[model samples]
Target chain A: MGAAGIGGGTVNLYSWLSQFFGDPDRRHGPDSIVHRVGEHLLFSGEALGWALLLAVPLGLLLGYTGKAAGLVTALSGAARALPTLGLVTLAVLLAGVGDTAVLVPLVALAAPVLLVAACEGVRSTDPDLRDAARGIGLTHRQVLWQVCIPWALPALLAGLRTAAVQVIATATVASYVGLGGLGSYVVGGLATRDFAQTIGGALLVVLLAVATQLLFALLIRYALPAGLRRARD
Target chain B: MIRFDGAAKRHPDGTLAVEGLDLTVPAGRTTVLVGPSGCGKTTILRMVNRMVEPTAGRVLLDGTDVAQLDAAKLRRGIGYVIQQAGLFPHRRVIDNVATVPYLLGWDRKRARTRASELLELVGLPPETARRYPFQLSGGQQQRVGVARALAADPPLLLMDEPFSAVDPVVRSGLQDELLRLQAELNKTVLFVTHDIEEAVRLGDQIVVLREHGRIAQVADPATLLAAPADEQVAAFLGRDRGLRGLALRPAEGIVLLAANTPLDGWTLAVDQEGRPTGWQRSAETIRQVAVFRPGLDTLRTALDSAVLSPARVAVAVDHAGRVIGLAPRAAVLDALDAAGPDTAAGITATGVADGR
Candidate 1:
């Protein structure tokens, strides 16, 4: 299908759709569409896990203490402006092609979004509520836990959803660093001049991003306390 | 009693919010600190709960230094209500009211039971417990704020203009509610406000403050109005302070005339239920009938009723709101004279003002 379709001077879009739903020939193997989707998720999940581990606490600490607000804003702005693809290429050049190289850029892309959301989530709680929390006999630690954290959760989750979608869409770059993901279909198809594989892989990334968004929407809707849910809108 | 013994707060930027001050807030009574904005009355209120640590001297609560006590622990034992209510929007009304009880480590059922009682105490209906703070009206939110503050049954309450946010009608209702609550609880309350009318209405002892939390005058509501310490205080007390003083005294001890006592020209008309309908002067009838309850209403209301009546007689009502008797304008003035101590003190206060 690779050379035959390309050399014959015609690209079949229907062929890509069939392969996207399921690859009948390589059904259960690592080379199959299912395996590639799994790889894409793992790559995104690992990067997000590391981003959350590093960013959430730091963001909350900065927000709680209300220190280094300017620094967080500047850092997030700089991170948002950064080119994820360029960073991925640079990491691959510096450390050689591997999962570590792909993960670094994806984490860089996700962490800033998370840090800002967490920081803003805590920071955005009503000042009156904070004052009441302290005045009503809550210790500083208790105030953060019982009031600030709960108040910030929905905003933090929204940030998580955004970061997740961004990371999942971007993890398709992992294939360029010789990591197995949905991006492999796009990269391998282009080298072999297979348009169907390239288009199918791009469609898969969109599907993953959409699914991640829905999952977070559900999380935010059901996980928050009823009072908080009412307060937000 | 909460005593401020040369207590002071000088901000790091060198602004003196309150100078070295000595004041005693007597227990089981409301002592209000009132002044204009930036007068540091709020700063002074915060001292009792250790919310604002004095830069110099000390604040003693019942003779124990509040500074020496743990801040959170000290605060938990003091009830606090602020202007905006400051209720936690994330919590249900019951949980918000239950805050201090929960903080004191009471179990869920016990804390909630106490919360239910407090909600009722604050005049909130039982169904209000499950609603969120956002769902309630501004006045209802303030009630919840008061209920939350009283949850642990704290002996001291620090209220910073707690009723100021609501409209005048609501503010009056809340003021009446506070009066009722204070009568029952008698907590050692330290209230702060910019409004002198509110101070006069609620304070057992009003401490009028000038710039930098310096005392302008400290006296009961009647005396504060009747005899302000100086022109600055007189101006601060406003023009109709003598009339305002009438509000502080009740309409009791006023001699009521028989309902059948006919004046020179005007005759009182009554409904079948014995309620006053209007004043009839020959063929002409005045429909706007003003009445006061002698057992319940203040002298200000009684005088207002008499002045507003076309017959120049205040219709006195019973507990059932039926017309019980009539009081002439002369009788209300005589009752004002019989509230002798306030008038005598007021004259003495003027003498002191002139002497100064």
Candidate 2:
């Protein structure tokens, strides 16, 4: 935190980041930056998990059969325009409660991005590979599972990476309804005029988002098939 | 034997891909369905595997309707190869080859062992087995495709333009490998191609096709070349097919002159082991010595060598690349006399100048 230096020195953004990461005092205390980050991640992860479960199979089916693909394109375009806060408020009002209230909007925010990516990924798999699989005696389901799915993994991972970041950022809104995420610090800090706590909380969320991005980048590097990796090279 | 009894295919848009295609492909032989594009060669080949079922009539594999067989089980029992190899990019070369065996529930070790052996059988280097398909050259990848198709040791193999994607040199090499494999394994092959030259080279019974899967003629390469069924078939066969026919005839009967004999002031050179090095004329050495194996090579190769040689004669070598003797262009041309009327008339009409 950019804490006021006692007497002579003035703290900078670097010191605030350092304090946010290092010190166990103030912003770094229990129920502070680390604790709030953990809480934020839990909310993001659960919402993302639910979204993936519901969206992935549906997306794959749409992509494979080539139905509603255009609708997804239109829907995904529309998804970006809808405000996340408004969605959360609307969901809370309608659902009238708790963890599910936060989750509904967070999932709504995440699923379309993942769904569109998965559908397009699977849809764009090489026709040659598909023909070869069918020609080589694979059953229809086997072709989809063994060849189509593996070939579409790059798209799937890309979709997951995008959704993961979006969900993480959106989960902060949970603090609006007295939820205890990193967002709580921002919401509480503004209410109590504690700007340092707000900056520290915001920085932790940004750090988490960057880490998620890098994690997906690593997944792309090590988890992708050698052939596709060679293509990247 | 595989038989197509009036097999036909009409797409939903009402375009007839094949119409009343009736053909019998014999066992233990390479039957090539060859035509221009849209002639239904591939459609016919796919019908055997039931990949594209016939709209009418039937395709029977060994007297059993292929339509009646479970497509997956049928495909597992028969090998299929396609253009650009259609290889699974994710699989390593060895795993690609082992695909069918693995599909058939062979243990991993057993499947891989067979795959490695097949890699060698296709004349690929042993190190190729571990590399991914993208890492291989076009020809090497096609070899892996062949190895994969043969993994299950299927009684029948369907090949669709398998070597067409490679350059002529690699195409010929792959073609020769297929012939060698066919000779050893004797899998009944139904190969399809648009190239007439490949058809003549690889086909034991070449089925010439016109549009709409119509069979023009089915005959051995030599017979097809010697006597085409119609002017259309003859035109497709090309005007110079008589000379090309010598490709199928053995060069064994062609007599060779002593290598010591000089021609065009150039003397044939040899290494200590009797393998040909080049042609020697005065102080200069000609780097390219077109040599052919008399007992093993086709007569066309001997003639080509004779024409290519600066000494105005082909060098005949034994299997070890040891120089056996020399063949003058005239003698090589005269050997065509032994091929019956077509060969004799070709020589009589064109004479020696055009023959070279």
Candidate 3:
């Protein structure tokens, strides 16, 4: 824990570097780094899927109706204050340790970010646009789908990017609830006194977050209306 | 035809936007509702399309009550244009123009074809169809707005200060374009504007409104300027209403003197194209020779030319811009007298000339 620790930590930089690039001895069979990376993605992706399922329609509805806007902001603010560890612990106690315990807090973590983004995206549609759309004979439903949704896509995607990054970072807590994901290394490393494994696992999570951000960045670039893209550039 | 029979709109706050309004907009003609701000001219225009539902009364389109019609369907059958052009920022110009057609469930190819036709009709270049609204200037956006409104070929058009956001030069150009389009298409248009000059220039029948959509006067452009209902309307028409009235009359009736006739000590100079170059008197020359076309130009143009000319005679030209003859200021005045008192009462040839 003295000179062996680099940057005032017990983890050796040389060991951490080798572990990051080389095959790990700890993971056997399906628990390999590649397999764990996939599990981590699946775990975080499920959380995001659940968050989007719950938040998107609700956000679109609130945004289109322009009702309960304050509630969205308040909910997002309160969700931001939630401690992932505490939620995971409570979820485990209430529902028993499983995917549900790991997922509950991560979904809670991601949904509000998405909900606020979706709501704001739709709500920020130019009032003049709504008026013109209706005047030009767009039905209420048509206005919502044709005008509001397309206009909201950029903001919604932006929110998705933010939520995806947060969910990936926080999904490490899955290891706390007896789940298999990239978080296995950190929890298992700490237990076995293998600090290099902890650092390498943490680095993998960082890589995953960056990858998600880049993926969404490309989606936003391609998915935005051509006019919107031109305007931004 | 659209009729507002006792149409009134009272807001939830008990504010009257338009009170007990009774008016009829004739079919296939331009009717402009013009007044100062807060006069409810826009409200009156919106009523025809049911954008503003008359709270106390009904608006009738053709023989049926507009209130009874499905609002979206009714709006689809009537074109609506507003200030800021209100073009969808996300759509290409063609797609924006094709909105109504697309909403009507027309096939994409057909809608786009109609949109392209409309863009050309509104004087936009073919390439403009591929660009977005923001890529164009304010005036071009307005042209696209007009094109979009006309895409479905609706029988009626509602324009709420459609050209007000543009510069004065562009506004004039748009007004000219509207006039040209109106001549060819003859759609029933209800235009709202705060500018009386715009009302006179574009309206077949101008309705001057007071506060709360009260009708101050409704008359053809000439009569409205020549004879307003009261002092308020006269003031609203502005101090130059008489001179403005001349713009509505044709220059057809003026008696022209021979092109070769000599003015006292002054000679008309002509270029190789036979267009008047200047009025020459010995070594001195007045290079500015105001000219007008008798068949195509307005009485105002004729009068303006005569007043602006150094020889006090308007040079008459044909379509080719070659000299046809000349109309002295007196002859122009005589033509004004022949037109009738309704247009000539407050206006005098000297008054117009002196104003310059």
Clashing pairs in 1: none
Q: Candidate 2, which CAPRI tier?
A: medium
Residue A180 displacement in candidate 1 (angstroms): 1.8
B221-321: candidate 1 lDDT, tens digit per residue: 77888778899999998988889888877888888988878887888888899888888878988887888898688889999999998778888998777
Least accurate 10 contiguous residues by lDDT in model 2 chain A: A1-10
DockQ of each: 0.74, 0.57, 0.74
Residue A117 lDDT in candidate 1: 89
Model 2 alpha-carbon miss at residue B176, Å: 1.3
Candidate 1 lDDT over residue span A1-233, tens digit each: 73245433323466566655555644677878778888999999999999999999999989999899889989999999889889988998898888889989999999999999889889887888888778889999988888988889998999999999999999988988778799998898787777677878888889889989999899998988888898768
DockQ for model 2 equals: 0.57
TM-scores for all candidates: the values are 0.94, 0.90, 0.94
List model 2 lDDT by residue over B162-181, tens digit each: 99899999998899899889
Q: Please give, for residues B34-76, the per-residue lDDT of candidate 3 as tens digits.
A: 9999999888888888888889888999979999999999999
Tens digits of lDDT, candidate 3, A71-171: 89998999899999999999999999999999999999999999999999999998988999989888889998998888888889999999999999999
**Model 1 stretches astray by more than 4 angstroms:** A2-11, A19-22, A89-98, B341-356
